[model samples]
Target: MRPLPLSDEDHQMLLKHGKELSDHERRITDLNNKMTDTLKSVDESNKYLREQNNHILEAIIKGNEKNDTHKQEMEVINRQNLWKVVTIAIGSSSVIYLILQQLIHVIH
Candidate 1:
């Protein structure tokens, strides 16, 4: 029906409904803006976290490489020490045998 045919009550009711819808649209727009801002903040946080994790992973890799190098060096040192110990034990035994032999010769 034309606006001219509508009663005052119906016009007022329609105006109130339109105002309510306008208010709802404004609220929806505000909520959308806030959600966009929140999403941007979240994205920034995610990016920062990813960078930190990458740095940590790099450090771990470097540490593992150092550990491997140290292990190899320790193996070489251990082999050298084993040989030194064996040589000392053999030399001491030989000296002891020679001293005992001289003592037996003098006694006889």
Candidate 2:
């Protein structure tokens, strides 16, 4: 296809349009850079929050472990007290039985 020749006025209008397009491109590039920087800032904040959350989770786990250990110790103490009470009751019953047997023999 043969190229159409532009008139002088048409050439001037084309130059103005080119300048406007170049300005628009520069603005778009600047906006893209700002958006990338904002994204990076948000990513950094998210990483910090995730680390804090992990720390909190670890602390909670430690506290739970301590509570479990304390509960186990309490159970052992309760068992020991129960055994002591049972032994005392058995000894008292045996002593009473022997005293009753002696009293019956004397009466006879």
Candidate 3:
């Protein structure tokens, strides 16, 4: 169908409204682009932080393992030392008892 001709005043109004719509569309596009860039930057930052956190956790686990090994070694050393002290105390007591018995027999 053939379109009806617009009057001058109607044409002017339509032009004005078209310009305003174009401006709004451009502003919306700019805002959408900015939002996309911001989201990409945030995603990159999150990825970097996750990698660093994984490294830190691995280091902590290694440190804990080393600590456990040292504790076990110390426990073994302490047990050995305790046994040595007990042996020495028993030997000294036996010798003292023998010496006292011999001295009493000679005096009587």
Candidate 4:
């Protein structure tokens, strides 16, 4: 098959268009590379944030456990204090009665 020959001016135009196409291809390739890098950076950030959130949740759970233990200890201490108060009030009433009896005898 015979090849069709292009005139000199047509050849120049074809060469110019090919160069422009190469430039557009290079730009598209660079843009794709940049987009891929950006996605990777975003993925790494997400992972870091997830780790931080996990640590915070774990710390919160530990704090809650400590609070529960403190509450139980406080409840026990309050019960003991209540019993001591009751005992002190009974002893004080007995002493007051004894003193009143002694005063009445002395007056008589």
> What shift in Å separates residue 60 of candidate 3 from its native position after superposition?
1.1
Taking all chains together, each candidate's TM-score versus the true structure is: 0.86, 0.74, 0.83, 0.84
lDDT of each: 0.98, 0.99, 0.99, 0.99
Report the Cα lDDT for candidate 1: 0.98
**Candidate 3 ranges with C-alpha deviation above 4 Å:** 102-108
Model 4 ranges off by over 4 Å: none
The candidate scoring highest on TM-score is 1
lDDT of 1 by residue, 1-108 (tens): 655777999989999999999999999999999999999999999999999999999999999999999999999999999999999999999999999999999999
Cα lDDT, model 4, residue 6: 97
Which residue segments of model 1 deviate by more than 4 Å? 1-4
Which consecutive 10 residues in model 2 have the weakest lDDT in total? 88-97
lDDT for 100 (candidate 2):
100
Clash tally for model 4: 0
Model 2, position 4: C-alpha lDDT score: 100
lDDT at 14 for candidate 1?
A: 94
Query: Candidate 3's error at 77, in angstroms?
Result: 1.5
Model 1 / residue 101 / CA error / Å:
2.2
Tens-digit lDDT track of model 2 for 1-108: 999999999999999999999999999999999999999999999999999999999999999999999999999999999999999999999999999999999999
Candidate achieving higher TM-score, 2 or 4: 4
Question: Could you give candidate 3's per-residue lDDT for residues 22-79 as a string of tens digits?
Answer: 9999999999999999999999999999999999999999999999999999999999
Alpha carbon lDDT of residue 87, candidate 3?
A: 97
